[model samples]
Each structure stands twice: as structure tokens, then as C-alpha cells.
Target chain A: MAARERDGLKAVPYRSAYRRVAWFVVGALLVLGPVVFTPYWLGLLTQVMVFAVLAMSLDILLGYTGLPSLGHAGLFGVAAYAVAVLSTAHHASFWVCVIGGIVAGTLVSAVFGLFVSHVRDVYFLMITLALGMVVWGLSYRWIPVTGGDNGISGIPRLESHAGLPVSGPTPVYYVTLAVLIVCGVLMARLVRSPFGYTLRGIRENEARMKSLGFNTWLHCYVSYVIAGAFASVAGVLWAYYNGFVGPTYVDLTASSEVFLMVTLGGPGTLVGPALGAGAIVLLKNVMSAYTHRWLLILGAVYIVTILGAPQGLWNLRVSSPPRGTRRTRR
Target chain B: MSWWRVALVVVIAGATLVATAQPVSPPIKLGFLAPLSGAYAQNGRDILNGLLLYLDEIGYRAAGRTIELLVEDDEAIPAVGLTKARKLVERDGVHVMAGALLSSTGYALAPYIDSMRIPMVYPVVSADDLTQRKRSKWIVRTGYSGSQPNHAFGEYAYRVLKLRKVATIALDYAFGWESVGGFERTFVADGGAVTQKIWCPVSVHDFAPYLTQVSRDVDAVYALVLGRAALQFMRQYREFGLKDRVLLIGAGTTTDEHVLPFMGDEALGVITALHYSAALDTPANRTFVAAYRARFRKIPSYYAESMYTGAKWLVAATESIHGHVEDRAALVDALRAVKVADLPRGPVELDAYGNPIENVYVRKVERVNGELQNTVIATFPKVSQFWKYNPSDYLKQPLYSR
Candidate 1:
């Protein structure tokens, strides 16, 4: 098996050096973005980065594992509410709130994962959607804890370990950028690892992988949990950035938006989801300023993208390459 | 001539042109943010049309400055509203902001507007906190707060209707809670007991279950439903045979004029309270109704009236300061100081909290010439947002939703 994998890797040379250089340049520009743009743009870019993290997490399950989830925002929203409630109600520290949010999100997703991992196709989608609706209902109906539709407001900014004010746009942007880069690198490695390969094999042919002594359901459950944990991180960042959390953040519209970002960017690619998030967020904010028919324009763009670039906007260039031509050497 | 000599000559010519150019004062950019494309689009468009109509009536010039309106859609979402509001202030550099259609959006943008030091006039969003506990100096609510009409309705329900016992069937949200709380406070204080409080979900399609749960012993039912939900609840209430059994009263939005035309005879004789009514017999309201109907081809709802009043108030304040909106603090002060004695909705003045102290009309949904109308039955004069309670006392209490 190892020899066959080595031969597969040998079919394509590694492009690590080129990829590293590209990342370094991207990182530099992201760091300098705050200084170059106005505060408004900085705030918007910060939101884009936060949502990019969320989109990438959704990509992990939908792209890699072939697990379509409509409840991704459920995990994200629960974590946000956890952080919001803890920070506002219990006055928890930033690190404690972050940990609490991630743990809460993971726990909820684990339970949901356990229940839905065995299901396939539309059933999985339906179950996940139902779960998402349940979370939305809780947030909307639980007046005492979630503040109902008005939501929990007056959330304080993130306090650093040194107790410095790290809640401003520049600091938040840098923090989000650093987290996004680290998460992107880790996620890339995860998808390339042996375990990640197993998940992909399962995605391609679950029966073949299962017959080869693989626990496909276990793999999917773990992947779902991990994806949910990452989504929670984005949720915490969002809650703090917006200084508020409401049911709308976790509603069906938000979940569908995450799915749209993942699919629109090229589901399987790490950078695709982020790019997709950036495109959609920028479109909504920028186009909305010019015309009231922005939603119509957005729908038109989606239709055009689907028709012109079936693989995705980001995959336009890569479509020309043979399927295995771009494979990297192990 | 050499290239450098020709360049120098052109530079001199450009400098001379610059020096002789008249300094044109930039237009006063007034930003209007509302949900122009989402659930409340109709209400939003009506508000915008009302504002634009006033601008058109005044020839778009206010106090020697051309009033340039910068409109943006908030999509009725808080986050979107905040983003659009920021764009309006930061990118377009609007001198004044106005026209928010949702309470949540208003609540989200209020603190941001205060931080930016931009004076904002709210037309329709009526979260009570914007005027009470969370009041900002830079914000003036030209529209009614959630509690304003409800407070008056409570009085009317107790005094005029002579109801000793009532029940509330309100939408389960901040606005609903505020409306119910205001009614409960006043009704209970006026020697009336609330028999039951039933909260239905905002998106409930069938309100029959909730309607059946409403106590039959109550003298009146105070409802706080809005939009299609209101339509559904009213239809169901009548279908369940409860409408005739009990006195149905509510906030004016329950039988909004915009929806009344389509509500048929189902909404007739329904009593509600609000700050504005198109059926107001005053000369000012008569003129406003005529102009609005002639322009929009529809009777103006309270939202339109509020925004029209808001625009008129801004114009009056701008005229008072001779169009100097550059000084936001002075403009806000002028806005707060100017009292409208004969506006479309009658006399209105800004209270200390910058919320309007106006007459809340107790209106009845009556049919006149086969057209549904909110006919003013009684008026609660000089009602403040705090109702009869002291300002500080009201602030000590948490928000109704909380």
C-alpha cells in the first residue's frame, strides 16, 4: 500500500516552494491591508476574514468528506451564543470564552454527528437541516438566555492575555488573519494526511473503503466534529467583531450562505472557500450601496458562474489540467 | 515653442483657472437607510416616497443648500443595516441619517451613529430603548416608540372601553413584549387586570391554537401582531368566533392602513392606537392625505406619515440654522428645539430624551364609502415615551424583552 502511494506521489512533483512563496506574499498584503484601507474597509475585511474561516470549515466536510451539512451554522451560532452568554452574563475572559465556545460547538456537533453520520445523501441533508432549525428555534424562543429575536447585545471586545484591548478593527483583523493562516495550513495538512486520504476514499466509494476495514462513519463523525470546532472559532470571532449575536446568525439563511460560499469557491480547494466568502461578502456590501436591485445582480452573477465555470470561479484555470496531472509527490 | 515652455504656460493657465473658480458649497448629503428589498420593502418604499414627496414639494432645496438624498437598503437585517449606515456616513459623508424600518436595525445603528457623532432621525423603527434607557443625544426619534401608542391604548381600553379584564396575544419579540408591557403597566395602574398573556411565535401560520387558548372571560383582547401575521391572526380570530365575543383592540399596525384596503370588512370596527391617522380631519392632515394619495395612488400608512414628518422636521431644523448641517451638534440641537405646532399629525415636540411628545390617537378601523380607514376616535394629548413614569424610574427597569 505504501509503495503504491509512493508511486502515486511520484506521478506529480511537489509544488511546496511555489505554494509557500504565494502564501508569504498573501500574508504580507493581508497584514498591510488595515493600514492601507479606511476603517470601514478594515471592518469589512475583518468580517470577510472571519467568514472565510467559517467557509473553509464547511469546505472540510462538504468538499473532502462529501458530507453536505445545512446545520453548519447551528454549530457556529451555538458557539457564538456560548461566547456571548459567557462573556456578557458570566464575564468570562477571552481565552476562556473561546475555549467554551469551541467545546460547546464540538459537543453539539458530536451529538448531531453521531445521529446523522450513518445517514447518506438527502437524508443526511434533511437531518442536518432539521437540526439547524432546532438550534434556530432555541435561539429565537429561549427569551431569557438568547434574548429572543432582539439577541444578546453589549458584548465586550476581546481582552488579550495581557489584558490589553484587542477588540479594535486592526487588532481583530490581525488576529483573524493569523488564525486563518494557521487553520488553512493545518487543514491543508489534514486533507493530505493518510487519515484524510481515507476520508476521500470513503467519499469516492464508501463500500470499497468499508470493505477494506475502514470505519467510514467514525471518520465522518470525527471530520464533522473537527469542522464544527473550526466553525465555532469563526463564530466567536464574528460575535466579538459584531459586538452582538442574534438568531439571524444561526438561521437557515446563514447556513445556506455558508454552503453557497463553499460551493461557489470550489468545494474541495482550501483557498476556494475563502475566496468565495470574500466575493459574496464584498458583493453584498459594495453592490448594495449602488442599487436596490443588488440581490438580482447577485443571483445573475451566480447563474453566470454556474454556467461559465462549472467547477467554480477559482477552478477556471485548473480545469484545463488532467485530473492527476497536478498531484503532488508524497 | 519648446515643450517645457508650453507646459509652463498650461500650468499658469490652470493655476489662473483654479484661482478664479468660484468655491461651490457642497450639497448637504442626507442619507436614508431602510429595507428596500426585503420583507418590509413596501413599508420602506412608502417611507422613502413620503420623504421624497416632501423634498419635491420644497423643490429639493432647504435653507440655501441643495438636499442631496443618498438612499441605501439595509435589507431589514441588523448587520446589513449597520454596514449600510457606516457606508452612508464614511463613504458618502451624509450630513444627516434617517429612515430605519426595523426596531432591531435601529437598535444596532443607534450606538454606531452616536459614536460617529452623526445626528440621525428615526422614521419608523420604534424600539423603546432608543428613547429611554439606550437614548443617544445625536439620535432623535421622529416616529413613535413601541410603547407610546400602546400606553395610550391602555388608557383608552380602561377608560373608554370600560374593560375590567383583558388578555394579550402579542408576537413573541422585543416589539411585542414592549407593547404588551406598556399596556399592562397602564391598564393595571388604571384598575384593570390582565387576565392572561399569550405570546405566539413571529412566523406562526395558524393562530387558531393560540386564539383558542385566549380566555373567554376577558372583556378585551390586546393584540400586537403585525404584517401578514396580523392579517392571519385577525382572520383566524373572526373564524374562531372570538372577534365578536370579545372587544379586539391593538396597536395600529394590527390593522395597518396599507393592509386595511385588502383586509375587506374583516377589520371593520377594530380599535387600535397610533400617532398618525390619514383620516385625521385637521387641515394639515387633509392636505397631506390629498397630496400622498394624488402622488402614490394609495392612502398613506403611519410609516409614510412618520417619514414625511421626519423629513419636514429635518427641513424645519435646516431652515432654522440656515442650512448649516456641517455642525452636527448644533443641527441636533436645532432639531431638538424646533416644535411642530401644525404638522400632518398635529402638534409634536421633542422630549428631553429626543423622542417625540405627540398626541396618540385612539383610532377605530371604520368603513367610509366602502373604504377601510383609521378614523380618530379619541386623542391622548402630550404623551411622553416614558408614559406617566419618571424618566429615571423608567430607566432603572430593564427592557421589556430582557
Candidate 2:
């Protein structure tokens, strides 16, 4: 794949120009997607973007920090339920609900991080998986607050944005796009920071980073919380988009899906996870329409990815930037 | 030459207008939402098969318009149900909706269906509030509510059976609570005592602990275990030696046809209550049973019968309005006004709240031709979700809970 990319890059003199034009077209299409596509596609794309944010957040922990937190959906679902409960029960304003969701996500992440900071690899995975199941149980059994399995519904979308009405799927799509862009940029910067290099160093050799007088625990803990906060953002967007939250969001299946996104997208590359989220979401919603055996197709995709492209679809390209650079660079 | 060309153009325009003015009706799109793949896939498939059977019998044409069915799997998840609901309405532009299995999915979908002004008929969702306090004008239910049949069975257990002391064991969930509540309310009202009540989790694999707690002095044991738990509970009930001591009675689902074929002699002599049983001997039901068995090669459960009847009810309403389903309000009004007398489940009519008022059958698990079947022993005709209580008074009370 690398050799093919090198040959293609050499063969095409205007490769960068072509990339620039491609990006512009993609950006413009996304911005005006609601105008051209039906509301169904818009709603679907909004979901893809929301999940992309979540997958990117998981990438921060699993890809960058080498923390395989299987229970990441716990953080995501906490935020979603928090926002849903606040908006539906308290009738709180939109900003208050979003803030509450982020805080709830971050706080839970902090607590989970504190507990799992001492563990790594499989142990970390097991602990996170259990913690995620705990959240799922809470959501399913806490009937009064979470509405149990029926879930809390009829949550209004962003009622207003800076005095402009934001009532329909079209507006929701734009808001999700904006949030995705902001999260993508911030995550990109975070991954390239000195702190990021330190995480990679710890991932490479944690004992060496500790010998250099760095608080390796603090780095992992902070990154864990940060990833959770971003996941919460996605959760909040999802609550508003779907106007509902249920126990399924906190279950192990959801956690595995987000983890799958990171692995399938090229875990180390932030862009790769986002792309993977889009691919999986589209595959699910669209393919299921044609065949009920779409999950089997998904299983096939995962197996092929593991066997064929261990680095994910993104790094398969020769244009991938050198190591230690901004992860999104092509 | 100029005069002839002008006349020719006028004639072509006249012919085009006449061709376009012919009465051409669009096909009615029906969107079906259910858990097509998951733990509930069997029930979902049954529902789909039942509905298809009915449509097939009618030649898939309703009220002078062809029916175009669009099926989407919710995977038994509420969020997925809502997403599919959106896709069905916004993308596929289905004129009517039907086929949801879960009470949770029904509730999750009610608000959205109302907001979209798409008339939906639920065949199997039994959530009480869907037709009670949280009732929506756009939604109609042809299936019995969670406690509908249980209420009738409870009355029978006290009055006809003359049971004085009954102990109950039910799965710990909303459905279980509601089922037991109905039985308890009527039994206690009719001057019978409930000796003991035990609640088991839905994931419970063993019933020994709860079974051990059943009081020995009770005249009979009333249970509401469902799905896989039903088989396990029945087996353990016999294994623990209580089956010989006390009569085993339960909600119709405990020995429903879906799981009845797999049950050993453990299910024999069990009495239960449900709206529809394949063993019903009515002409309507006999025809339906024969057709459903021929098509699916299995006895139709309440789930299949409910959707089958629901499809008939939907078609009745659509035909009543001559297939003008494009008018949302008229379609919903037509649904509310439908009174089906010849459905496979017997006579069914929508009560004031748009839930079916149908017959609740008290069935006994009897061996017929060496196969266990729910034979209709007694029938409570025109049973409502409100049971015997006045609608207004029933609305004032809290939902049935343990």
C-alpha cells in the first residue's frame, strides 16, 4: 500500500492541488448537505458525525495513550442520560443541559480514571468493561430517573442558537458538523502537543518516562478525563439529535462499537477513527435496509481489517505524514 | 398549411390533458417497525408473518390502492426504533404504520408518531399508558394491554373457580407487576386472599429460590413467567413437587404457543388467560389457524394473531375511507371508528382511548392429538383495558403496579 501511494504521488504532479480541491468540495457539500439530501440522509449524517466525535474520543485513550478502556460508552451514556434527564425533567435551558452533560461525563471519567490509573493492557480493558456494565445496569434499573428501558423521549432539539431558530434536522446537522470540526481541531492539537509525545513515550516505555521524573499516572488520568469530556460532547449532541436516551447506549455492545471504530479507522490517527465511525454508521443504517444480515457483513469487515490492514484504512495511503506529526496530516 | 398545423397542435394538447386527467391512485406505503434481529427476533418474525398472511389473503390491495410494505428492524432498541421511525416517515413516506413488538418501543414511538401525524396501529405492544393516560390520537392498538386478559382471568379465578387463597410468582418488571396487579385486584375484590407474592428478575436462570418461598397453604399458584423463563419455571414448579399440591395458573403467555411446543408434560393442566389462542374453535379463528399453520408451519401465537387481526382492522379503516390515507386526520379518525366483528380474534372494537375491546379467553393446557394446546375453556367478551372499572375512574387511579 505504501509503495502504491509513493508511485501514485510521484505519478501525479498536482497531487496536493487535487487534495485541496477535494477538501473544498467535501467541506462545501457537508455545509450544504441538508439542502441537497433528504431529511433522512441529513439525520443519518448527523448521527455519523456525533458518533465520529465519540470514536475520536476513544481514539485518544485507546490509540494515543495506549489505554484500552472498553467501558468508554459508560462515559458517553452518562452524559447523554444526564442531558436527557435535565432537559426533560427539569426543563433546563439548552446551555445548562449541555454543560451538565459535559460535567457529568468529565466527573465520571475522573472517577473511573482514578480507579484504573494503576492498570494497563488487559487489566485496564477488563476494569473498563465492568464499569461500563455498571452504568448499563444503572440506566436499566434506575426506573424513576432514567425511565428504565423505555427511555426518556420527546427531548426538543436545540431550540435556538444565538436568537436564530434551530428547530429541524437541517439545523441539527449543521450544529453537529460544527461540533465535529471543533473537536477534530482540538484533538489534533492535543495529540501533537508535548503532552501527546509524552503519552507516546509512555506507551513505548512507561518505565523510561517514569525514570525521566514524569508523573506518568497524571498524564494517563488527564487524557482519560479529556477523552471522556469529548465523548460527552458527542453524547449531548446525540441526545438532542435523537431526542432520546436509553440503556443500550451504555451497554457493552455500544462500547465495543466505539472501540471497533478506533481499531478499524487506524487508532493512532484521529482522522482515521472519525472516518471509521462514518463508515460503520452508514454501513449499518444503509446496509440494513437491503439485508438484515448487515451485522454479519460488519463482522466480515472487521476480520478483513484485522488481517489485511492492521494500521487501518487511513495509514494504507502513502501520503500519510511522518511519525510524531499532527495525526490528521495527509 | 398554417391552419392545419395549428389544429393539429390543439388536438395533441387536448389528448395529453385527457390522458393526464385519468384517475390514477398512488400505492399506500405501510412501514413496519419491529425487532427483526435480536432476542425478540422470533416474535418479530411471527408478527411480520402474521401481517403478511393477512395482506396476502387480501391480494395486497386495500381500498382500491396497492399496498407497498416497508419493513425496518429496530433490533429491540428504543433509540434504534426512533431512528427507524424517522426513516420510515421522512424517507420512505409511509402512509400508515404498523408492527411494533415491545411496550418500550411503542412508548418511544408514540410521541414521534403523533408529532409526525402518521397514524400507527400497534398489534402487540401492551404498554398500559399507550392507550391510557398518555394516549395519542394518531395511534391505535389492536393488541390486548399487558393486564387486559389477566384482569378477566383474575375475576374467573375468584368467582368461577372459587379459589380462596392464591400465591403469585411473576418476573420482576413492569409487565409482571401489571399482570399480577390485575389478578390481585379482582381476586381481592371478589373476596379471595393472595397468600404470597414473589418477584424474579428477567435474567433469572433458576426459579428454585423463588419457588421455595411459595406458601404451601395456597389453593393454587398464579405465575406470570414468560419466554425462556416460562419453560424453566414450569419445569421447576413440577420438579419441586408443588405442581401436584397446588394448581398452576398464569397469564396466557406462560403457556403461549411460541414456547408450548417445546414444553414437556410440565405444561399440562396449566390454566391461563389471553385474548387469543390458536385452539379457539370459532370459524374465523379456524380459518386463520389453518392458513397461518400452512404458511408458517407453526401454530400462531398471540403475537401472530394480534398482528393478523391488526392488519384486518387497519384494512377495514382504510377501506372505510376509500383509501384516502393521505389525509392524516381522516385516516386516524377512520382507525378510531373501526369496529371489527369477524377478525380471527373474534369481535374487536376500539374503545374511547383507541385500544381494542376484545374477548379474553381463559384457556387450559390440554393434550389434543398428543400435542399440548391452549383450549378455550371460557371467554370474557368485549373486555377493555379498563376491565370492569369505569373509564374515568380507571384513568384517575395510578397505573397497576406491585
Candidate 1 chain A: 10-residue stretch with minimal lDDT: A1-10
Q: B153-243 in candidate 2: lDDT tens per residue? A: 8889998888999999998767787889888988898899988988887779999999999888899999997778888999999999998
DockQ of each: 0.50, 0.56
lDDT of 1 by residue, A32-97 (tens): 987788878987898888889899999888877888899899999999999989988898887888
Any idea how many clashes model 1 has?
A: 0
How well does candidate 2 reproduce the true complex, by DockQ?
Answer: 0.56
Model 2: CA > 4 A from native: A1-15, A160-166, A319-330, B1-12, B191-196
Q: Which ten residues in a row have the lowest lDDT in candidate 1 chain B?
A: B106-115
Q: Estimate each model's TM-score.
A: 0.91, 0.94
